[model samples]
Target chain A: MSVRDENIIEVEGLTKAFGDFKAVNEISFVVKRGEIFGFLGANGAGKTTAMKMLIGISTPTSGKAKVAGFDVFTSAEDIKKNIGYMSQKFALYDDLTVRENITFFGGIYGLKRQQIKNKSNQLIEELGLEDVKNQLVGSLPLGWKQKISFSVAMLHEPKIVFLDEPTGGVDPITRRQFWEMIYKAADEGTTIFVTTHYMDEAEYCNRVSIMVNGKIEALDTPQKLKEQFKADNMNDVFLKLARG
Target chain B: MSISVRNISKSFKKVQALDQISFEVAQGELFGLIGPDGAGKTTLFRILTTLLVADEGSASVFGFDVIDGMNDIRNSVGYMPGKFSLYQDLTVEENLTFFATIFDTTVAENYHLIEDIYVQIEPFKNRRAGALSGGMKQKLALCCALIHQPKVLFLDEPTTGVDPVSRKEFWEMLKRLQQKGITILVSTPYMDEAALCDRIALIQDGKILDINSPEEIVAKHQHVIYDVKASNPHQLISLLKAYPTAHSVYPFGEYVHYTDQSGEFKQEDLHAYLAHNGLKEIVIQPTPATIEDAFMELAN
Candidate 1:
């Protein structure tokens, strides 16, 4: 398939249920390759549940999804192999040196030792972490750790990346630099799917989907969505949808 | 009914947390302390609430000095720290009653004060405080804080991780509380939230940068900001930054907020320059300053 024609993720009527309670109710959307798609919702709005299903970590009770051109249910392992994941919580080992953490994650992704060494060098220079390469991951500042976490996630060169609130506590300047990194990744044909409570970050996405009461309430470009809701910003757009 | 801080400074060993910070909260006024993390907001809140003594200077709540009137201040102030401090093992009702008993009052006595918030959480009164959702937990905490009907409320980043809906509802609750003559001093890292308060103090590096109403702060922005969008926003930022006339170029949402060294910037010149530089799908327009813009100006 051509890069432009490929949809990295395609979901139709995706639903997850625990007994009678539907955590994610009949959500459908398509994410194009190299696009930054934002999944947004209030706390307990089933965003996590839906995301778990898409990432092949949780089973869906009904409907269908295709991630990285593989069925979410039957090809879960293949899907996992082709995608990277990062969450608000730092996933790196705090006790390990920066180089050690990168090498370990690279090994988990089945990269060769030579490839790991080369990638580590490139990442260290790109992130300006050459001085801290030998320092323990825990001792670095939060902003540096966040940037490193993101770099490590992209080390394996996955087709798509999933970021769950990657900049929760980061300062504005750090957040801007983080977005630039995301843009660079997207530019390199890595589809980006992220979830965040920050409305400003939501505005940065190519398209955003807002969930309410376990269902997709609205999905569109930020500008179009704002115009549709007659709201000044994404926050107001979210408030109008969530309150309804 | 009011809070006054005069030259309050605190240090932790070698690191200075707060430096000569001074502000006044009028009776029943909703004041906001706005800044990023490690900006001395929590330190100031601690001193004002009588939880910690400043290394230097004086603070008073309701005309009572923090050092000498700790008991009086404790009696008349409601403090909700950034972290949820309620008993996780206790049920919602149990926690409320516990706080009431400690304050030498029953929930019934101040039922009127917490009715609006209480009724929302009443359905889940049997649930443990830990089991409640973030929004519900916030409401329950506020209810417990108000059980004694304190004259002043200090909320430290109360809506930090909350969703937009819950944040709006929480602000509405604060407005209601203000109507009941309760002075509120709230601190948050969210710049957009600064607008919700009656007055805001922008703080950074252990100092107050500016204090004014949100409108006044925005109005005081001297630069003419233009929201610029191009095919590639990241490249656009770098391009604008390298431009000789560009003063400040920062990424704001989807667009790059650009300001020129000169107040009088022409859109045609920018358009021609971008076109000459082989940029496409460019959109540039002047946008009104927001609380975040004002905060960014002061922060720099």
Candidate 2:
């Protein structure tokens, strides 16, 4: 059943502060259901901070955020249950086998024994990981490990998946394959919200929000933003916006 | 040829690091080894520079075998790793001077070669390498790598983590370096960076997919390309993928780059279909293919 609610995430004047530094300042936007939203910024931009708020890990100092139809402050537990998060360096036990990692994460998400087994098998098979299912995660190649991490994040089947620089340090082919998996999930009606430093990856998002300093300077589809900025590509658009 | 490799392969604890990866660099050419992490890019670089050994194959720098003439290869090739691998504890000048001393040379010996980049970070020569900003660290690393007047340079993703502006500056520096007849073999994950190289080898999972100039790669993609945009791009991508004639549909910036299975499918069909499906503000325009388009086509 399609949720009639237009907004999966609603942020209103959200602010995140760390002592004297306001890492995020009054940022607000709505991420609709099943939309692939790209959050772009330089190294220290408030992208991470703002995402942290939406995911309910970091409390906003003021304003309001309703994610997965749960209030960020009061319904954090509900929000957590409705979301899956994958950081740049995803939390995968390197010493564990691929199957073991899948099981562990699935267990944590409160899946039953048969459900975890069935889902793990399905994920491993879909990703063509059957050959390496017994291999230690640390022993697997970077690209394979990234795919496994992403699969593990979705093991619980959350309504929204948040990936923060999931493609960093990997090669182009692996990135392409990783994006294919993301598209597959979105096709299944899972909202994908991700932050990336790569401009090309930003282009893959349905919509992108470019953050500068502590505020979002531009927000639109990659083509609109590129044309409005008079830039040939997202990289040039980002440079013109952020550097200015 | 400035650099050549013969049947070079490496393995790390049962993992095939590089499988007979062989390529050569012409003098003054900017060659790029484009791949993801662990595509054996760094491993290949280490072997070429004699920093690591290869189980099979051989490589040479300016006619000197890397294994047999390790010292000579080290003396003639400048290498910058993906990470800033310089001494983090030492000051910028100290690190440069230390590298110079190890090579039995001095910064003054090749001051002209590195003058442009070194000048930017010269004021911070006394500051610790660990304390320097990302861009400053990059410049310092470049200065140290070029201080010995090497004939060839190997940069393994030097622009990976640096900001876009800094990355642009770094590429400009490489262009200037190339102008002086230095053969550069740089590895990067960014496809856009491949355009900066005279030629590039696209690698995936220890296998070389395609090797050619960036323009040539794009030229090889024979497809009727259409860039389609609508009020709801996500919905549009799904709709496009579901279309019976859709050969491939992938997100391209704000629009979707789509190719049809049938040789001749018109944009009017797409517009009418999208409008019927409740998509609004639709615009379907033809666009020239890019390196990414070619890459995606090959991948599928």
Candidate 3:
């Protein structure tokens, strides 16, 4: 199958349990390559648990899944190398300069030195960060740092990038700009697996899955989900599901 | 005024956290400080709560100067910082008791002050606070903040990362608190929450941009926002931005919110331009402006 038509991630009956409690239970979903998929839920709604399994960090108690065409059970290392991840709390190294951080991430992703240099320059230029390329990431503004962190996550040209509540607490303009970057990445055929608290952001995704308790309660286009739930917006839809 | 701030300024070494900013919150009013991170919301709150002193300007809470009458202010105000600050190892009830003791009171003395918020977490009283869910942690923190029945409350982004359901529920609690005549000075990055405030000061980059009722702010500066959609949103955004008359274009939800530089213009001219550029199913409808739109305009 062509990259556009193939599923970058396929999961069936994904379950993760700690003792007697099922954190993520019997969840099944397919993420097509280049699609912006929003995984949303309430705060303690097992998103982190499910995400850990998908990223190859935490082992699933029972399930069959493939991430970046690699089986989660046997090829966790391969899945790690083929996917990129960034979160609001943790992204680039704070003490590292913008250029150095890019080079570091690129090297970690197995890029050659020359390739790292080229990508660093292109990335800095794309973000218009040439002036502050040598400044420590710690000194930069939150929006600038967030944008740089996101671009750095894609430094290795990973097939998919997972963002966790990436836009929380950012200014309105910066949040939209961040989404624009996500849109550009998805357009370039990198599947974007993102989670956000902003309901409007859920609307930006091709498909959104709202998790209630430990199961996927609703998954569809924002419009269809709204219609199905008889809600006016994603906020109402989320409230209706999460409150239940 | 319940809270009064004038020409307040503070800096951390080289960074000016709060510029010469000023505003006032009347008694029993739900005042919101709406802005994103590093907009000086926390700095202002800290100064008012007597945790930090401003380099310039003066602030008074409940008629007590923040610089000189800190103890008086402390006794009259309740503050909940953005971060979860309750004693994690302590049980929910124990933490509430600790805060109440520190305030020279007992939970029973001000039980009614937090009765509405406390009952929600009473079932989990014996559970360690660290094990509580995010929503429950916020509720418990709120209860602690109100344990002493302070006349003024300062909540710094209490719902920053909370989900929609919890955020809604928290706001409802704030409304209830307000009805009880407790003046609140709350800060949040979420613009939608601005409407819940009686008046909001749209702040950014260490300065207050505008302070008004959320309704008047949106109602006055709407300037005819247009909701534009096309076959390809990415291309549509770029094209609209390149249009000579485009004032601002930002993707809201499923559509791009566009405004003309001139505010009012011919709709056909733009429709013809998009259609000529191979765009299909073009939909351009006027939509009401929101706090986000007003912020973008003023911030832009």
Model 1: lDDT to the true structure: 0.89
Deviation (Å) of A152 in candidate 2: 1.8
Clashing pairs in 2: A171-B36, A223-B254
The candidate that wins on DockQ is 3
The 10-residue segment with the lowest total lDDT in model 1 chain B: B230-239
Model 2 / residue A124 / CA error / Å: 3.0
Better of 2 and 3 by TM-score: 3
**Which rank order by lDDT, best down to worst?**
3, 1, 2
| Candidate 2 chain B: 10-residue stretch with minimal lDDT | B291-300
For A48-143, candidate 2 gives per-residue lDDT tens digits of 788888888888998899999999999988899999999756569999999999999998999999999999889989999889899888987777
Stretches of candidate 3 above 4 Å error?
A: A1-3
lDDT of 1 by residue, B119-169 (tens): 999999999999888899999999988999899999998997788889888
lDDT of 2 by residue, B111-138 (tens): 9999999989988889999988767988
By TM-score rank, best first, the candidates go 3, 1, 2
Output candidate 2 Cα RMSD: 3.9
